[model samples]
Target: MRTVIRRTAVAVTAASLALLVTACGSDKPDAKKEAPAGDKGAQSSAPAAKALSTAELEKLLVEQADVPDYTVKADAKAKPVAAAGSAKADKAACQPFADAIGGTIATPAGQAVRMAVLTPKDSGKKQSPEEKALAGLNALKSPATRVLLGSYEGDGASEALNTVKNSGAECMSGFTVTQDGETTKITAATPMTLAAGEEATSWSFTMDMGGGDEAKFNLGLMRQGNTLASFYTFSLGGSVEELPIKVIDAQEKKLA
Candidate 1:
């Protein structure tokens, strides 16, 4: 993923360099100011092209393959949470976090899916609150190496679905959760990468869930202004809810 990002960066740099060269060449009025007699016939058609209607221009833009469009997730939800407080309260406060499940849902696609998230404790007994939270999560029995957070890009609905498909979990089971008088079945799991402000990459995994319903979930966490917020989208038409979140910890014993 880092390699993908590096390549993109290099491409942008190259494009900018080309643009700079073009600008520098334009500064020299003596350089090829007049077109050749054979090219004059082609220049006559330029004004007609510029006279195209707005709709025509839009159609042309759509037909262009190289034109990039920022994929927008339709009815996408973006929830934000803070990163302060005790671990238990923080964990229990957010159902999504507690459930540790999220992903896109399509018709005939919604089903029973269970997910879990885990991280290493490192080598600290009285670890930081964040560390304790991660350790407690690690203690839970699940796929040992599949822990992560993820970010989805492009069309909102598909992006969410892709987030789940890429989560590296077997089939996603739609967990039934009640919210606002309606029982909403949603994908539960942790995120691959925690995106604070800037865009991040999506996470993927490949593992088998032995009869026991256990899978580490990735949580999208970031500090919003002064408070922390977690990202979430319930459905394609759902609005993003920025919920206040925190990380708390209880006194934990040292691991041998």
Candidate 2:
């Protein structure tokens, strides 16, 4: 059991928690279509938005100082989708949503920054030994929250946000995504209400990890100008019914 836990933990951290999910829900006919590349009218008339470079994004991403109770660090494993089509959705229309959960932007971004925010092992003071032990267990049950900040030029940020929204609406009940040969099954996807930045959207997912083991994964997105921020929460050995508001709030402030 411990070995399995360790392996699953690594995969979850590796954008494999960055994500690959499956769902049992039947297909819905409401999938949305994007404008054709050749359609000039499809393009926006507003002046192009300036995207923050990778270096700029790195500085803008949430830091340890901003989240005092959590350990925030760069995520070495979170990278762009593989060129070999390693991360793909079972339903073509759901690809954008899948990509968002896997630590990448749906619409292409000029650059992105990824980070992992680990929950504190204990909160408050004056804990008895038993209390400390229980706190440790609680901490173990709470998985790291992965954050991604993506910047785009032109209207890519809007495109990215729309793509994710449409996909979530289409596949809210379930879907499957495979990353590097392993599959992540999302048994349910529940929409969330959030107010931040220029626009925001979020979802809570029930991840079926097979063998009767399951994990709670909550995902949220917010866009400020040409930048979009994504917060991904994954919990194992237990359940999580809420999104990481603190992480979202911190990133939203930085982007603002």
- lDDT digits (tens) for residues 70-117 of candidate 2: 556565664443321345778887787666766566444445555443
Kindly report which residue stretches of model 2 are placed more than 4 angstroms away from their true locations once superposed: 1-46, 75-85, 107-109, 114-118, 121-138
Top candidate (TM-score): 2
Please write out the lDDT profile of model 1 over residues 36-104, one tens digit for every residue: 221111111111111223233222221112211111111112222111121111222233222222221
List TM-score per model, in order. 0.20, 0.72
User: Against the unseen true structure, what C-alpha lDDT does each candidate score?
Assistant: 0.23, 0.61
TM-score of 2: 0.72
Q: Which ten residues in a row have the lowest lDDT in candidate 2?
A: 21-30
Candidate 1 — which residues are off by over 4 angstroms?
1-174, 195-219, 233-256
TM-score of model 1 relative to the true fold? 0.20
Q: Candidate 2 — what's its lDDT?
A: 0.61
